[model samples]
Target: MVRISSFGVGGKHKSTKFALYCVGLFGLALLVDLLWASSNSSPSIYQSIVSQENVVFPSFAQIKEEDKKKKDGIDKKRVLADNFADLDAPVLNWEKMANAPVPRLDGAAIQIKDQLFVFAGYGTIDYVHSHVDIYNFTDNTWGGRFDMPKEMAHSHLGMVTDGRYIYIVTGQYGPQCRGPTAQTFTLDTVTKKWRDLPPLPVPRYAPATQLWRGRLHVMGGSRENRHTPGTEHWSIAVKDGKALEKEWRSEIPIPRGGPHRACIVYNDRLYVIGGQEGDFMAKPGSPIFKCSRRNEIVFGDVYMLDDDMKWTSLPPMPKPDSHIEFAWAFVNKNSVVIVGGTTEKHPETKKMTLIGEIFHFEFDTQKWSVIGKLPYRVKTTLVGFWKGWLYFTSGQRDKGPEDPSPRKVLGETWRTKLEL
Candidate 1:
């Protein structure tokens, strides 16, 4: 039988055991050196990667805050505050004058010599004022008052004065979102007589009207439906409240059409500025045309018509504005100053907001800037420039500083010196 020793082996076995021990020691030393090197270099490597990428990793709290702001509909880009401080404009000191006899909205005003004539307007939801209220700037009091013609419109009328005569055209006759009338009339301030003129081919609400050259031009308002934008442009030749043309002439259509736009003729150029595309409409099949606010877009679009009779687009207002209509005046013979109006609705609440800033559009630069701010935000205010002062009266005013939504119909008149 072959016998194996319990403890003894050949010389080859001893050499193999020694070689295995040496290899195990070397592996242990290599592993320890690798771990030490990794520990020393890890922080520097991480910092180098961050610096090269220029990345800032937001904390969990910061991420949450950003998400909250987005959900609240707070756009950091859309600013609603008055920016008059940023502009180089004259300082305005506002003073209160005598209030009108009645509060009204959507009224037309024209200055004739020392007197300001305020025409028909909306008194309440169901009532409309057809009286002509006159204010005397010289006496700082409400002067003579007269009733408009029985057939004349109550609100949304386009009015422009030529010395002694005030032309009234196209408007909602009654109240509660009624359709507009095509009937046109002229009022002689001296005789206080109403004369009929050629009716508009198309009826419009709060159209832009101006006496340009020898013809009276009317453009851009809401249609008879009271919501659709009207783009038709019409003109009529007139001399002393009499139409020289048998029928109204059709001119080039405006690029964009809407109501409550500020239209003026300056330096023989006709300009239309700051209007809206949509408006409050009547409910379907309602007899009285119950007014309901609809989805609308107010804009700051500006257009000019020269002797070429072509419409030219100009720089828009600093922001989208509407409801100005008569709330503009010529200042310094080089710029037009527009007062309180409406702007974009709140992003989250979707409620309409009123404007308080006075907008200045420079004819020379063809630019717009915020010159001053009103005492309170309002819409549909009547504006006039007389004797180096800017006068504004009668409109719907905002609720308060916190709430920009219109609340009260105001008849108070206010004015500020035109320093610039």
Candidate 2:
């Protein structure tokens, strides 16, 4: 019998031990890498792994942090809030006229030649009207009514007017918490008839509309309760005496669901103000989601998209507001005013908020300033420049008791004449 004593196998045993040590180290490295990859294996990571068969790749864990940032949905091309740091200069004082109309909000107004055409708005809880409220600056009168072909009770829809026609886009028509139709309607100043246009590709409300190069441009709004929608642009075109043709185009998508009431067109660039989030739909008997049960407003960041379709972040509004159905308007060619919109309460109250702040940004100065407030306690106030005055019309004040409770969608009117 060959006796193999404990210390008898000299050099050969030493070599075997060294080999074992090296194998153990290799195993440890492999184990560490497997654990790392397992920890970082998302669906994308797995897809990558499945594609690589024999290659010893770096652990997914090692690169996971970097991948998460790259995978984020935030827009790199769009500039957002904070670009308006240089926009704090005082606004050029425009003349102010208070002897206008009754205090109200959430109405549509337009400009025709030298006149401001004010139309439908809600007055109190459960009251959405279709009164075509008109304001004549030359005559200094408030109660002139044009009969609309069909009455619409909506808030936060895009309200725009060419020198010849007035257009009302998608908006919420019922109570403060209700949703509006996704329809487009226009009023011919000459014919005084309401004609429906091609409906939006999707149903939405609270979008921004402005006239650019004779084309009526519309952007932003909520689609099915989601605000950060990808669909962002549409326009209307008319040829001399031909019927109006509606054309829909896509611009660079906004970062999220809305441009909301924070949209204005100045010097051809579109300035989108703060927007809101959460569900605003009112299904007949469905229970409201807890998150949507109360007001859940969003960022105060201001953003501007120039004609070149480039987005630049602007300094935030002095005060943050969201879901303000009527919180955005052009105070003048050089300023933007945001009116009755709130961020704290879901079913926004009828407690009138006169803090209707105006943000005046001069294109020449590239600055912003908070100017005056709207006259009446209001919500979703739409402003149109006509005959050298700003028209405020139609919106909800006090919402009703329950989801479908009686609430007012007003139809009154007011006017603001700037001193600039």
Candidate 3:
């Protein structure tokens, strides 16, 4: 019959079709939900790639502005940290060495190997040291004293060394602000004997002196009056501790001239640094040349003489400094370290002030920095550098931290490792 089997097969086919339709509707609903969620929240993979391509970056001007702000912040910090009185500066660890055999001031010191030779200086208002005091760096003691030539200047002398020979140039021959002597001499350290050189054509007091290009060059000192600034520069050919020329040759005058300046030859170039425009002069017609302070201007001018024998003005020190004729050394072969010296007078008190800050000058950058302070303020401190150590022997000390006036001459020796 039309049969129950055929009807059962058609019914099964109809149920299968309905199930397929229901599955299609569910899949469409899930796909639509995913599309709506992506549009409202997290991007789909295709949408993310398109967004990345359209992303904006900062402009060059904006980047520059940010960099400038950073630099300004750094500059402000540097300024805040530059105070000289700040305790965070480098520690010198200045250990006391042997006191000098005698107190002195305005002396010249030179180091040869393990020995430090202290030359003529002012011992007192009336007395001047006529002996050379030799300090043995190895033993940390003074030894092997010898008398300077009776004719040699006893104070305010300019001294420089080349090998075993020490050249002593023009200076005040006696105490009490006496006139300078034209006489110049050389002493052989090996023989401990002195030889006379042709006298400086013009006598100078505490002139800047150095050996450069086989010539002994001298410049910038007080004239005969002891107060007039001398700008004359002279040189004489020298070889083997002897003069090659019979007379001193004239060179270009220094722009400014005075005593107590430091001169050095580095990289075949000559440099002159720090001095005063005037000095104490002898009262007119006074016997023994009684000394009295005159109007003076401490200066920090720096000059460099090049291979072409032309001088170029260089950047000056932060403050005026003078009386540092021998208070300097070449450190690390790239910079100069100047020790204690005299600075500008106090603003209100009008009294002289001593410099305690260690001045560092860089040859490469032609810049200056206050590296450290001395144990106490001082002036005319004889300085020497040996085997990474800095040594200062004699000087005039300040009365106190607040009092800028000089108290007394000192013979104390101090040493510290060369940290900078």
Candidate 1 has which clashing residue pairs, if any?
none
lDDT of 2 by residue, 29-101 (tens): 9877765665474434444555445635546564665466458953322322222111233333344344335
lDDT head-to-head 1 vs 3, winner: 1
Error of 2 at 257 (Å): 2.4
lDDT of 1 by residue, 39-68 (tens): 364333224434564854434464455557
Candidate with the larger TM-score of 1 and 2: 1
* lDDT of each candidate versus the true structure: 0.85, 0.56, 0.84
User: Whose TM-score is greatest here?
Assistant: 1
Backbone collision tally, model 2: 49
Q: Write the per-residue lDDT of candidate 3 for residues 61-169, one digit (tens) a residue.
A: 6445545755666443344333222222465789999999999988788888888999878888898999999988788899888999888888788888898899899
Q: Which ten residues in a row have the lowest lDDT in candidate 2?
A: 78-87
Q: List the candidate 3 regions with Cα displacement exceeding 4 Å.
A: 1-89
**What would the TM-score be for candidate 1 when compared with the true structure?**
0.81
Question: 102, model 3: CA deviation in Å?
Answer: 0.4
